[model samples]
Target: MAQVLEFKLPDLGEGLTEAEIVRWLVNVGDVVAVDQPVVEVETAKAMVDVPCPYAGVVTARFGEEGSELPVGAPLITVAVGADASGGSSEGSGNVLVGYGTSEAPARRRRVRQAQPAARNGRAEPREVPAAPAAPETPAAPEPARPSDGPVPVISPLVRRLARENGLDLRELTGSGPDGLILRADVEYALRAAAAQHRTAAPAPAPVARPVVGGETRTPLKGVRGAVADKLSRSRSEIPDATCWVDADATELMRARTAMNAAGGPKISLLALLARICTAALARFPELNSTVDQEAREVVRFGHVHLGFAAQTERGLVVPVVRDAHARDAESLTAEFARLTESARTGTLTPAELTGGTFTLNNYGVFGVDGSTPIINHPEAAMLGVGRIIPKPWVHEGELAVRQVVQLSLTFDHRVCDGGTAGGFLRYVADCVEQPAVLLRTL
Candidate 1:
């Protein structure tokens, strides 16, 4: 006999609580392998392919596409025995953080007393003793009473919605398969209650307002929402200051041209700027640190995890290059290229989007001159590079048309004073004006 093992949505890491279903890769009757990606979901940070840990024939799916499901909610149920398919099913070692299956998942199971929050959407999480697993039976279209059985709730988010509005779960019947109460049912119930209340009391007069058309309102969710929240938090929390300078980038441009002309692999200007930033960070380690508000301590990082801003159709995302200080210019170029392509394709993982010690914002690609970049939260500084355009400047007491660029440094005031910030900027400018200076650190 096939035991229907329910696979809850495994927790996608990086503090993400919920994800909207973007697409389902498998149907109800489709056969899934262990660790095979079964669904694609969009969290606040990035789009993730959620893989199922159990290998079996998928019997049921929980949520529809385009709907948001909280972490730990039932994602799918797989019949995991020889009868499920020609071959028996087992657990995969490769599983996400929150949930996983042990060996012999088909015969025995651990009843995870997952608080409704993750599965149901509850505050406290506790573990219960393992029990002999049983096959899930099709439930009738009725609410289960308190003494009868567990509440027929599909998502913890629905439970929370009904809870916040003071709706009783046992009073209303479930509408989903297996008597699963869905968000729509709770919302409809709340709306009906609100209408009855309004009927009992006189409603307020409708406020008149001019209707405006041709305005598109896009919901701030996913990457855009994440960016907005982080930027807002940065602005509200960090005491930031911006310092800028114009530098002759002719030498830096020439050096890059020379390196590419004689190179096995072409180097990128962003990579060169990143190299300079790492050097400057080494000179001023305070700029490569984060301020811990609670500890009231400034945490300095030993190595650089360089984050660069890449604008994609999804919005602005900063893809990180880990251990950037250890990477050469050629390696940085390749990593940056790979990450940028991932960002464009919306395939950059959450890990690729976080843990940045210092950010290099090359807004030059947009044909802009300079910008006081908002520091990515938790990180203490950002180095902005502008377009290198031809400008007439004094070259050894003589006016000449040279490739000039504007560099701006935005630093957290709590981390360091203006002297340190200025010194760091000056070092970077000096490197652009004189590429030979970078060789000292190299």
Candidate 2:
């Protein structure tokens, strides 16, 4: 006899609570090996392939693709022990944060069958059917329920949509397997109600407005939603201030060109800017510190975990470079390239997306001159770099066109005052204007 074991969504760590099912890798009745990826899910941070701990035949799956499930919710049930496939009963040793296989065998519980109701005049307990077993074939669809019974809905979002639109879910039949109510069912009910209202309404007055067409609404629930939430929280929680300066970057550009001409590896301009930011932070450690509201203390980081903003097809993501202060220009450039590639391909893990003490945003790639960036939360500051363009400037008391860039620093006011922020910005601007100043620190 095969003992079936249920697997729930494991905690992906870093305070993530839920994940949306992007795609299912295994189907019911399919054989799977231990530690094999069974499903692909999209969390707020990144896309993850969840692995199954048990090696057996997949008996059932809980949710549909595009459905969001909370952590600890049943994901799938695997029939372990000796079976048709001759698989082992022991679970894999691999472990995620919240789930794993142990050396000890799992204990099984036996359910007691309910007693039948008495036929006599005396009142007796009614018998209740046992829960359905995992089917070898596809799970049977749920039978239609009485009007007074609760609707078969799993997602809270589906219920919320129906409630917000004033549609009663009990009155409609769900299109999903097992007669589970879905968002589409709620939407269909809403559209049918609107059409019925329009048909029954009297002729509209001349002053009445006509219905508009061709408007599409997209839900903000994935990467876009995550970015929005973080930015909004940054604005609300951080008392931020911005300071900017225009610097003649002609020398820095020339130095980069020379380095690439003579060098083993090509260094990126962003990496150069990141190098400068790290050096500036070293001088003004106050700007590198975050405010701990609950502790009522300023927390200063000893090492720099620099985060750089990269815009991808998914949305805007900030991938961090660990120990950036210790990396040289070449190393920083290589790490930046690797991270940017991962960001573009949507392969960045949640670990790559978090744990940063400061951020460097280069919006210049989008053709913008400057922007006051919202600080990445828990980080004290962000350095925004603008496009380096030719501008008329006084060089040696003579008017000439020079390669100039606008640099802006947005800092948390709770961490430092305007004087500290200005000083940090001024030091960064000086480095950009004169690359030799950076050589002193290097």
Candidate 3:
């Protein structure tokens, strides 16, 4: 006999409670091997491939693509034992949080039938009612009402979209199974509302009314949602302050050019800036620490886990470089390139996306001069670098055009005061203005 085993979604770690099914690799009746990836899911952090711990024929699948399922929800059911297409009865030893073969089999729950009341002190056999026969015509579903309680919305992005547009999700009909509201349904409702608004408005004679369309709404889920949640939390919880300085980056640019000209592996400008940041953090260790809200104590870090913000098609992601203080410009350049590629391909792991003492955001690529960046939560500070452009400056008491860049430091006020923040920014600006200033720390 084949023993049907259910495989529930495993914890992806980093406090992720749920994940949306991006695609299913296996279907019903498909033979799968142990530890084989059965589905690809997108969590707030990153895209993950969920592996099945059992090797057997897939009997059923739980959710459809794009449907969000909480951790421990059944993902698929597999049939084990020789009768199940000659599959093995033993499950693979590979372990995930909720799925493993080492644990004892779970006991099935049994339901007891209701007994008839005693009649005249003697038990009388009650007549059992027959099950209702299926009607020839299926009845129509009941109309959704305002008192239907809360709408079934799994994605926070969908809820936010409806809330921002003043659209009541309960009034709209969802195209998903079981009336599960999705981002697309919210967008469609918005478009319909806009069309209705335009039609109701009176138009002046001899004036052409422009058609309102072509609005593209990308759902803030996966990596984008993760970024949004982190930034929002950082703004709400942390007492953050920003300090910026315009530095003559001509020296830094020149130094980078020289290094690349004589280097075995070409160093990147971002890597050079990262090197400067790590050196600055060493001098001002206060900016490289986080506050323990529960303990109400400032937790200082001995090593630097530098996170750099990388923009991708999926959204903005900060991939951390582990022990960045120990890595040189060449090594940092290589690591940054690798991580950036991973971000682009959406292959970065949860480990790469977290555990940073500080962040370096190079928003200069967007062609902006400067921005007061929000600090990455739990991290004390973030160094924002702006575009390096030609600007008039006094060099050696003579007016000259130099490559200048703006450096902004956003620090947590709870961790350090303005004096400490100013000192850190000044050190970084000095390094940018004079690359030789970094040599002292090196």
Give the number of the best model, judged by lDDT: 1
Candidate 2: regions farther than 4 A off: 95-105, 109-215
Ranking by lDDT: 1, 2, 3
Q: At residue 432, give the lDDT of candidate 2.
A: 86
Model 1, span 17-109: residue lDDT tens? 888886677766677777877886778777666788777667667776667888878777776665444455666757553334444443554
Q: In terms of TM-score, how similar is model 1 to the real structure?
A: 0.75
RMSD of each: 11.8, 10.6, 12.0
| Off by more than 4 A, model 1 | 95-214
Model 2: ten consecutive residues of lowest lDDT: 118-127
Candidate 1 CA-lDDT value = 0.81
lDDT of 2 by residue, 280-316 (tens): 9999998787888899999999999999999976789
TM-score against native, each model: 0.75, 0.76, 0.74
Could you tell which candidate, 1 or 2, scores higher by TM-score? 2
Taking the tens digit of each residue's C-alpha lDDT, what string does model 3 give over 1-442? 4456777888777778899886677756676777888987878777777888777667567776667888888787765555443545555667543324343145421211123454332223333332232333222235545644446764544665676567877788888889888778998999988887779975552223334653446677767778889989999999999999999999899999999899599999999999999999999999999999999999999999999999876788889999999999999999999999888767787888889999999999999999999999989999999999999999999999999899999999988899999999998999998999888988
lDDT of model 2 at residue 159? 59
